[model samples]
Target: MQQHPFQISRKIEYGMRAMIFLASQPMDRTVPFREIARRMDVPEDFLAKILKTLVERNMVRSTRGAHGGYALARPAREVSFLDVIEAVEGPVVVNVCQDGSSHDSCKATGSCTMYGVWKLGQQRMLEVYRHATLDRLAMSDLRVPEPAPEAPTRPAAESRRVE
Candidate 1:
């Protein structure tokens, strides 16, 4: 069987992480690519490409000079997750039938059994992502401490017999 088709691309993941790191910095502060790459553990070239796309999308600003760096084009709170993800991954098409158009309904498919389910699920997903801004994410990251590295797990024992 084919592997699941719906998976979050690594580009989107890295872009989001980079944004969070940038958002954690002061609004007026600009962070160099090297610093962001090191802190986020993303490859500098890969991150640069992602940042370039984000800059083109107007979600991030890039400066070139001896002390040049990157910063958000607007307040982190104003930049939604949808904006970042869309910049990296294009629109979020949860399913084949979830295209954004007036004529894009189950009617087009004639008889899709899961139409209602897909419609509701896709809308909820969009709403969640649309409202989830970087500021809220950064605050949550600040409040929560990073968990320690997990130790290697021991082998599982056989189940015991019931009495």
Candidate 2:
């Protein structure tokens, strides 16, 4: 059986949730870690580690002492889903060949005819992820704003005589 590489860790889920929570709050407010943990229903310690990783990636900012916790380093619109995923999970890659390295070791590496197809699929997947941002994800209503009303048009005199 061919083992598929690359899976999104539970940490990625928790990290995204934490980011959304921060995005929903006041921009300048520092939410408590425990509060985020409780709200997200994620294990406190595990979520803390995820948060630490986010901080190191500069995706989130941490504050110390009372009334301190975490907040997004940038606006939600400025952060992409890819950013959140990469923050906790590292760079995304589906296959060994997609990593752009020498394919000399494995007997089936270069000879595999499906390598190009797999690489193309990986690129498409990345493009989709790149376009999906946290702000778009958080916006529950997907309606387009209505256009401004136009000036009323005058009816032709002949058309007004229909009565």
Which pairs of residues clash in candidate 1, taking residues 3 or more apart in a chain or in different chains?
none
lDDT of 1 at 38: 86
lDDT of 1 by residue, 1-163 (tens): 5546677788999999899988887877788989889888899999999999999999999999988999889999898999899999899987777787643555657666787787899899889999999998874542335579999776555355557
Q: Which ten residues in a row have the lowest lDDT in candidate 1?
A: 138-147
Clashing pairs in 2: none
What are the per-model numbers of colliding residue pairs? 0, 0
Q: In lDDT terms, how accurate is model 1?
A: 0.84
Candidate 2 wrong stretches, greater than 4 Å: 1-7, 102-106, 139-163
* TM-score for candidate 2, residues paired by index: 0.76
Q: What lDDT tens digits, residue by residue, belong to model 2 across residues 93-157? A: 77777776665534697579878787899899888888888776763322223579999888798
> 65, model 1: CA deviation in Å?
0.6
Q: Give the residue spans of candidate 1 off by over 4 A.
A: 1-3, 102-108, 139-163
